[model samples]
Target: MHLLEGVAAILVSVCIYAWAYGKHHGPGAPGWAKGQLFASLISVLLVALFPVGAGFVALGLTEAMTPASWAGLVALAVLPVAIWKAVPRLARRA
Candidate 1:
């Protein structure tokens, strides 16, 4: 379903962003922090659309054009800021 795929996409993107953040921001990775955020955001946007692609194929394009898809689009649009705030806290826990 679109909901499930959307949720999965968001979760995976956050995890990827978190990992990239932690990696580039680590102590030994000096001067790399400046570009890490952009790299992480680009990575998330490029990678997270896979599940939605599957949803389109699984449900058919016509069927997929529903409220859930709209919500997914909004969620994807908000994802960068969410990950920006959340990933730091999550990294601190680890």
Candidate 2:
């Protein structure tokens, strides 16, 4: 169960981070990118901190799930992919 929770949490976190990365750094993102990013961060934090929060509740059922730790793992999983996808486009603009 612990392992499943960890995996689910990681997957969810990665998806959220990827969405945020695309929204902020992708081409033609809105002018309010900072606001959107802030909101996303807050949402992630809430999930990590509140067990009853949607993210927490979803991840809690899986194995090896701990709110803060899983969040970090998810970030680790997503950041590289997001950067890989975004950096090339950004460079072309440069």
Model 2 Cα shift for residue 71 (angstroms): 21
Residue pairs with backbone overlap in model 1? none
Cα TM-score per model: 0.42, 0.41
Write the residue-wise lDDT of candidate 1 on 1-94 in tens digits.
4653655565665666666667666666546555866676657685656556446435533464677666766665676777677777755523
Best by TM-score: 1
TM-score of model 2 vs. true structure: 0.41
**Each candidate: how many clashes?**
0, 8
- Report residue 18 deviation for candidate 1 (angstroms): 3.3
